[model samples]
Target: MATDALKNVRIRIERAAQKLGSKIVPDWMLEELVEPEERFSISINVKIPNPLNPLEKIPKKFKAVRVWHRKPDPADIWKGGLRYHPDVTLSDMEAHAIEMSFKSWIMQLPHGGAKGGIAINPYEWSKDTLEDVTLQFAKRAIKRGIMSPRIDVMAPDVGSTKIIMDWLRDYYIDYTGDNIIGDGVVTGKSVGKGGILGRESATGLGMHMALQTFCEAGEICLPKKKTAIVQGFGNVGSNFCKLAGEYNISVIGITDQFGGVYCPTGLDIDKLINFASANKYKTINGSEVISPTYMKASFDELIAAGADMFVPAAMEETITTSVAPKMNFKVVLEGANGPTLADADNILIQRGIQVIPDIYANSGGVTVSYFEWARNTRKFHTNPGILIPDNDETSVKTALQVMFKKNGNALIKVAKKYKIPYREAGYALAIERVAPDIKARNRMD
Candidate 1:
């Protein structure tokens, strides 16, 4: 399956190149094109070796590429996220890297994606221990020439947070003798560390917008009989729930690492947020009409909870062949990249589920990260003061407003421009723009 995804990605790139009448892109360029595949493969292989282990087994030694330097050349910065999961792999990072590159192109970002992660249970690690691990990872990545603030950049991803990002970035800074010039090497930093506002909610906001776009296109009035089930309630899931409520969509079910929650009537997001906030990290499902029911269950149960939309914000491979056939939803908005495996995707597509591919569906976080990268580069070069202090949020907000402001016009425009799915339109627009840039660079050389 991993090999197949990589092959498909390669075919896509080659087809894209052919359309431009260029020789096939170089292998190195191909790497950038399908970086996420490499990362996903490595992650899945390492975390889940066999069927017996399932989700319980953990890898003994998690491999990672890290680096450390006192000073570096100017063209080595890269950035992306680091995941902590039993199933993390280099292929997973590779897949994300490719998207980061395309996403950067879509937004006209100067940087590209470079993801990293460890195959371990983040839940088992303490803060101090995690910091130590981060520093070690940073040193290793730096030594391998796989990381730099100069060319490749990094941010937080699954099982990682602002604290981890701060620790990793600080390690880089300290190793470089406080190279103030390259602080932007690591993004998703704390606010004081130059991180942008709305970082936490950026992905969720984008998912909501994508859903809104999807809804407006079909003329489906939301929250009318609409109910949603979010598989993961961390930053992405919770934020998505909040935004969905704002749009008047009823999030009837939500789950976390602990358990699942459900209600017949709409669940009050504010109440759920407050309850989950205090109860460690458990699921909250209770209401006057539906009564409270919480228990330890598989993530698949959430999908079958009978909602209009099922959002797999949890992790990759959550919805598989066994699960997709049972899901009863109109649309599946992939909040997490690669959430639905290829086999499941085929099943869901045949089952009439509108599967929003991750490449376009989950691009919001990276889109904003691109904004941060743009701001950082401008500040770094002091290049005509091109840094955007407030434009990232404003621009995306405006674009979304345009997308949803008038449902009728937006629907007609989207339908007429592309008779395909909304997800395809979003990705096609991004890919079309990026392909030209790649071609222009080749021509210049």
Candidate 2:
């Protein structure tokens, strides 16, 4: 259940804040931030094409979104994604939305955190079925006033993609009769349809940048000798693998939901990336490229195979207590949210393994989403009251890389001074950024 996961997330936040003493921090933030300000349970009673029978349609029942923190959304503030996974639930959305709040706050995006998902496995449906259901959801969302450019913005998540977002943006534009200019309503669209240049691989790029910052701060050199293992070759993991090789970091192992492979001499990420794209972004086989001896059928074998870095980019709580102790990595670059639970994280820290937290590490996706939002909303002459500057991939990367290095140094300094783990230091840093906003809005000062 998401309850255990939610508790694990909150406990870490509380632990970090308490070390700072709660006095300077606004009381309302601790009490209020834990609970979402808005909860949306959209009932999608629609008939979608069934793969088994074209004459009949299947019914989809539910969709959920949680707005953790934002001003009135018409201020065009909240930003997040809609995931389509069989395991998606309201509780999980709530947790992800809260994480978005932390991510946006730390990245200083012009957004608060919001997220929702339709609990369906997209793999079971045909392309037509997927598009029909996505459009239905988009129409329902528009009719209910759940989404708009001047309100909440949606992006891609697990089981979601750029084409899906393009559909939402297209529908919104058509539905509004071109009155609202719907491109800004959802991000991560095809670049031809208002998507930003870096949006495709922003999360992975952001993590890579953060990794470089942390490595520089720690005086670690990235060479071909530095091997890395990445779990999940989906968008985030695959993009990261492509870029990590640029720094001469050899990715020795890679795993998708179907299977994984390991090669101490480093696998060809380009080959695996192409294979996964053809296989729905899930890497199943690589024997044609990698030596047959390096194939790992499960994540355990890859963990057992060993590397200097391990990225649990697939799912939450993948690095549990048992997995934590078995990990051979010197550092963990969180490519997925909440991949390491509290207990497992403490285990890694105790073993002197550095953890680059997800909120900071995987923030590239939302950061670029911000750029897309700025670009899409640029046509609007209306005053929602904040001035967001123009953005492209290059300027965004330069500005954010500098911010990341500065923040990384600050977090390390605080971690050293407080004698706390890097994760805790990150939470403290995020809290410090968020507190002033919370205080000003509430007149807490």
Candidate 3:
């Protein structure tokens, strides 16, 4: 499975480079483009009381990993998220890390790519136990040089949150005794704890902006019709669904990891958001209620729902070879990283279904995260404890310009220049930005 992830990224990188050829992108850089610079993983055992046998203790091992696809120069920092999910692995981290590099490069952030996450189900563990294990991960991570403000900046992802990030930040401050830059060690902290405003809805908002821009430019007319299916109701998916109606972009069907509600006509995004938020059965899946306007959806029904656009905000490898051919959408906006498999990508390309790639489409989270980092680091020499105000509307708009308008225009330019699709143009543009060799080659020409 891990190999598949890397292969998928390799396929993307090679294809992107193919458009430019060896003259502009040298052959030697392909190895670096396809492989990570370094990989580190740590696994430690923690004991929990056996559920049936309360007196007995059970030992469980948890793994946390970081992969650096593009190691930064001496003065730069490596940025990524620390996800807490059961399915996380080293290779998955590597693939996501490479995507981070691409995302940052295209966004022109002064940072390189890295990703790390610990494998654990936060729902199953008690808060006390979760905090203990998290602090343990933090102490060891800092000691081993796996995490630092400049070395590797952490953010929340998947099963992570602001509270968990706060715990990690405190531990780093204790370890380094540097009260100044400690908060900068991690973004996504609560605004009172040095987090930036608008971090939560950044990714979804960014996707919404990009999609709207495409519609407004007469690139796609789906927004006028509002026919779309949103997969995954987490931060990215839910926020996206909530904001789509602002542009009259209607979502006909939506699903989570377990199930969701589907309506042939547009479903009410606000009502769904409220229900999902109040749902106690976990955010992704809950018991469903049927109505004349909407019906409880099974996973199959949601995927089978036809629409002009598909927003996959759930997980990686969602659109497999079989799933790809069955897709009913004309455009796939990747809200989740690596949502489409390599073969699925080819199928989509062959079918003329354009993909708004994840590296560019869903970059709103990191884009706002960069805002948090810059804000936190700016106060490093001053009183670090002073909480910044949560005035993020302006910041969110700035992110829209950087991600949707600027990067979106750049992708169009590259696609036209190379006669390639947006996905290939995205990767090629990232490669062109990160590799100075292109400029050197162009000069020699």
Write the residue-wise lDDT of candidate 1 on 308-369 in tens digits. Answer: 88888877667778988999888888888667655565687688887655655566677566
The C-alpha lDDT values of all candidates are 0.60, 0.76, 0.79
Ranking by TM-score: 3, 2, 1
Give the top-scoring candidate (lDDT).
3
Least accurate stretch of 10 residues (summed lDDT) in model 1?
65-74
Off-target runs (Cα >4 Å) in candidate 1 are 1-62, 65-77, 106-108, 144-146, 217-225, 274-301, 379-428, 443-445
Q: In candidate 3, what residue range of length 10 has the lowest lDDT sum?
A: 380-389
Candidate 2 regions with alpha-carbon error over 4 angstroms: 49-53, 58-62, 70-76, 178-181, 219-224, 286-293, 379-393
lDDT of 3 by residue, 1-445 (tens): 5568778988989999888888656777777788888988878677888999978989878988888887434456899888888898998899999999889877767677888888888878888778877898888888888677767898989888899999998889888997777788998898888787788888898887777656666655563556788888877888888888776678888887667777787877776777776855355354245347777776567767768889999889888998888788889999999998888878888988888889888988887787688777773223232223335777456645545777778877898899888888889998887677434433433
* Candidate 3 lDDT: 0.79
Model 3 stretches astray by more than 4 angstroms: 55-58, 279-281, 284-287, 379-391, 437-445
What TM-score does each of the candidates earn? 0.75, 0.91, 0.91
